[model samples]
Target: MLISKTVKINQTDNRVESVSCGECKGNKNHKILVSAEMAQDEDSCFDYQVIQCLGCNRISFRHALYEYTQYQATSEKIYPDPKQRLPIEGINLLKPYIQSIYKETLKTINNNQVILFGTGIRTILEAITQEQKTPGIDLNEKINNLVKQGLVTQKDVGALHDLRRIGNEATHSITPSSPKEIKVAMDVIEHLLQRIYILPHNVKENLSSPLKNKPNTK
Candidate 1:
């Protein structure tokens, strides 16, 4: 369980900063921070000193006995882990699926477009995920940075997002994705390829077959 606390930040104090609270009124200044507790271990850690807010007189307290725990319980539902590992499902298979998507995408575009559209998109996503593992990393900011760096275009990034979302949904759910879902995922890959590469139209016709439908004799 976790709780939030609102506090004022001293300008000299780097810990707390002014922020907007969506639950409260418009642009009201508030510093939001979390305190977490584990029920099984009977352990509690408070993040009170870590941050301060520039807004109201409100100071939030997070504890098992506090309302914050209730908020956590009500706002977010926690489900038990499926006790599953990758290669079986989830992000693990994305690389291969993406590879297949790349081949199709290449057919739609030019040979020179391959590098820009290939594993580059996958690498970008993986980098974001890795950054998110640490609290200091902001995946959104990094994506923005990538755009500023001209390493990837916003259009290409958006298509990558669509593909990642479909892959995630397929992995998390027990029900296998319908053919429709698979196609959508494949489309994301294709879009990325078309946006960056230049491929021959003749090659495109030959590569029209779906990777999932191809027969595997091996």
Candidate 2:
């Protein structure tokens, strides 16, 4: 989600600022170019580009495009097996990009049990549907039940649909797609996965001492 807000820049009054890329910490740079309209004098609109980080390739924007952030609460829906992740196509690796994002998000949450907190339903459903080619009948019913249980929210469900649509298009296109399209799909999948899965269990164990644990943490 992109949100726009005004921030004071260089002592200049309020200027629009928004976070462009969440992972790489890059910002957006909004430059306005004037073009003559046929009926009107001039039209102005903010341009969009991810100001990538030199060291880490993170992206952010200078002008406020609404920032993209994960929802705190989520809905339940199991996803397919990891083997079902989007294809890398030209890349020799199998879903390495997606795996990296999973690890990165896990690190951010600083807990492993939390990994499955928001993802139990999605992971299970995807594993069943994608691997077994089963219909999504009971899966969606479970999702509704989960929503009633407060396992996930409507917004997360919508985001999941959006990500799945983009992923399906990139993977199942009849004609070969451009590298940029593949990259966007991969990035979107990674982002979606990161947002849904908080952190994996193994990560939490390895990051902390055995005695430092707390009850009912996740």
Candidate 3:
């Protein structure tokens, strides 16, 4: 049996905590709006709080567990997780499906979905190859095709292969990538997307007109 009590905190309560806000995309001060406690037994209890970010006014739920028998330590988790990486600049320039996959891949890593993270990374790479119409039967050959098409150089193929290996390990052997490894992989992907999609779009939008008007000397 569990006993619980809900408390409605007033605006004047002034209880604030530093937490990551999805809208703000970083840690900010959040004021507690409502709080509740449930006691599973004499030795353990759970705390739930509704918090609103002071900066962005974004709301989030925080849950914590306390055990008196375990030296009064507390374990806390935030609902909906927190944003880990912001969308890459000019992400809208990519194909719609690729943009969606890229955003979801970021979320997967942010939520600590290790297996999904690897798979997502792989999916992003494959989507790029498909969008570019690289001719290959499999991902390995497709990645190499990217080089022949002048999409990526020999140096970049090595990094793409590393990402492919990580994905394979996760999908086939159930291996989990570390956070640092995930971060590097994401960086590489972002760079590739920027070079192939965003940068070209930017150049065309910003530089094409200027170059067109330059007086030709030859």
Candidate 4:
């Protein structure tokens, strides 16, 4: 939406940037009907703009603040993957604690809160390690313990460690995550969940038939 700022806003002050119109359900340019300045100081000015979407001709209100020092845009809720409303819906068979954490993570992902997405993925790791009953001093050690238990292969553990590092970076870094990066990570998480929980359950259910006894100790 118009949440990202550009220096050209001063030059283009007459035109309100096109946003994803709720009525249009798509990005469309908007025309400003009024720019009633509400307040101003030496550094910034606030305004309430009445704008209409060019695509659908739907009118909406905009709360804007113009800053002389730097460009500032208002916060917005973004759904980069709207089709993925519940990114972790298939992880239902996982342990409740881990599943809940994963659902929360997906919520953040759906909101396009990049940093929170990473943190949420990291939390899922924590939940998995705990569920596997892997004991260690820290997460790295716990992940290694999971490897020892054969729940996670060594190579997978290495990749999980890398994800852990990236998650840490996301938690601390001010930079936002790109769609491609998060998509790859999301796929990995889904695969891991499938292997660790869903596949095992499927195997158990399929193998529950009466065993064919042969060469018995008669």
Candidate 5:
């Protein structure tokens, strides 16, 4: 039921709310630095505010929507959608282009760009295969070659194929992957990256000396 209500802009209302902080990469308490309200019509209004994160002192814009209906709850949105993911440890160990694509893919998922997310996931797989010099004419063959080359296991091949299919659907048919599918694909990709690049590098750097130490021979 739509009801008419007067919207009031309260500049002095000091309210704190939990909001996601891009800089902190998590939810934090934010204080309203400034606020204004605009009535779209008699039944709805928007609250615009400049909010500062209490933890990091980072500032961002927020838009909240309110409707005069019994069933509707307040809707709040943050500008530049709070970045919730951090770069994987040892991301720099990846090829520069792969690193760039990985970071952008994270942002794409966070922005809810479902089509781009699928494409990005597939692109990352392609770039990895290329960088590893996995020889194949197509993505399927390339993924299979990864197992033959010992870069990924046969079990991983199935997951990579899933990613390939998601990317194919998004690219050729413009089909958006569901959130659950995206999440699982992302987990698979990240694990693949760590297994292929990050973990090996870390082991070599941190454990090699101990493992390679040999008794002195005169």
Candidate 6:
């Protein structure tokens, strides 16, 4: 059970969902390497710990200050996890530099920094348009340029425009984005990444190999 959204530990249970591993690009189970607790009252306490990520053999420290009675907690990332996330060589979209930027966007969202998350998603879109070689004075023009250059279709124009609109809102601070909007933006970007990056890379690999997706005719 990975808690993708929640950051606080369940005070009474002495456990929390493992944080995302930048190296693995997914959540991995963790163990309390060391812990200390202080009781503020008979019914409340705070716990702090150094936890180890089991997946990539990396260590990072985070401490949860929790009050069990009121169910209040605040966390601090005492030591920044210095490990750079390994690129997904399996997908071309995981180019080291670009992938790092995208991962940071994910990290912001995971940490509940809602505004930055919108801006981050917007940056990803800019990266995609750049890679496609669609140049423009601004993102809207760049996206329109993509459609003009035949890199994108009319079918996809709406989604791309919607993503741009969200970014524009964030940049202008028109309104704060809801969690639902962020979730949808994440979905849209991942879909774009998969289609533009992963699919083409996989297609090339398949073409280079004898294996092909053919209809079975036995």
User: 188-216, model 4: which lDDT tens digit per residue?
Assistant: 77778888898888777776545663335
Off by over 4 Å in 1: 1-146, 197-218
**What tens-digit string does per-residue lDDT give for candidate 6 at 89-151?**
444456665576678877876677777777788888888877777889999889888778776
What tens digits encode model 3's per-residue C-alpha lDDT throughout 66-143? 685763227878876765566888998899999999999998887888888888899999999999999999999999
Deviation (Å) of 103 in candidate 4: 1.0
Poorest lDDT segment (10 consecutive residues) of candidate 2: 72-81
Q: RMSD in angstroms, candidate 1?
A: 21.6
**By lDDT, is 3 or 6 better?**
3
Evaluate all candidate structures by whole-model CA lDDT and list the values in order.
0.38, 0.35, 0.84, 0.70, 0.86, 0.68
Query: 5 or 6, which is superior by lDDT?
Result: 5
Q: Residue by residue across 1-218, what tens digits does model 5's lDDT show?
A: 45445546664277888888988888898888888777777776777888899999988899987685732227888876685555678899999999999999998877889999999999999999999999999999999999899998888899999999999999999999998998899999999999999999998887777634855665
**lDDT tens digits, residue span 19-132, model 2:** 333333343332222111111112222223223334444433333122114211111111221112232222222244434444443332233332231242234335423333
Q: What is the lDDT of residue 56 in candidate 6?
A: 79
Candidate 5 vs. true structure, TM-score? 0.63
Error of 5 at 102 (Å): 0.8
TM-score of 2: 0.27
Model 1 TM-score (2 dp): 0.25
| Models sorted by lDDT, best on top | 5, 3, 4, 6, 1, 2
Model 6 pairs in collision: none
Off by over 4 Å in 5: 1-83, 210-218
Better of 5 and 6 by TM-score: 5
Per-model TM values vs. the true structure: 0.25, 0.27, 0.63, 0.56, 0.63, 0.55
Pairs in clash, predicted candidate 5:
none
Query: Whose lDDT is higher: candidate 1's or candidate 4's?
Result: 4
Candidate 1, 91-112: lDDT as tens digits: 2223454444444443323233
Question: Candidate 3 at 131: error in angstroms?
Answer: 0.8
Candidate 3, superposed: residue stretches over 4 Å from native: 1-83, 210-218
Residue 182, model 5: Cα distance from true site in angstroms: 1.1
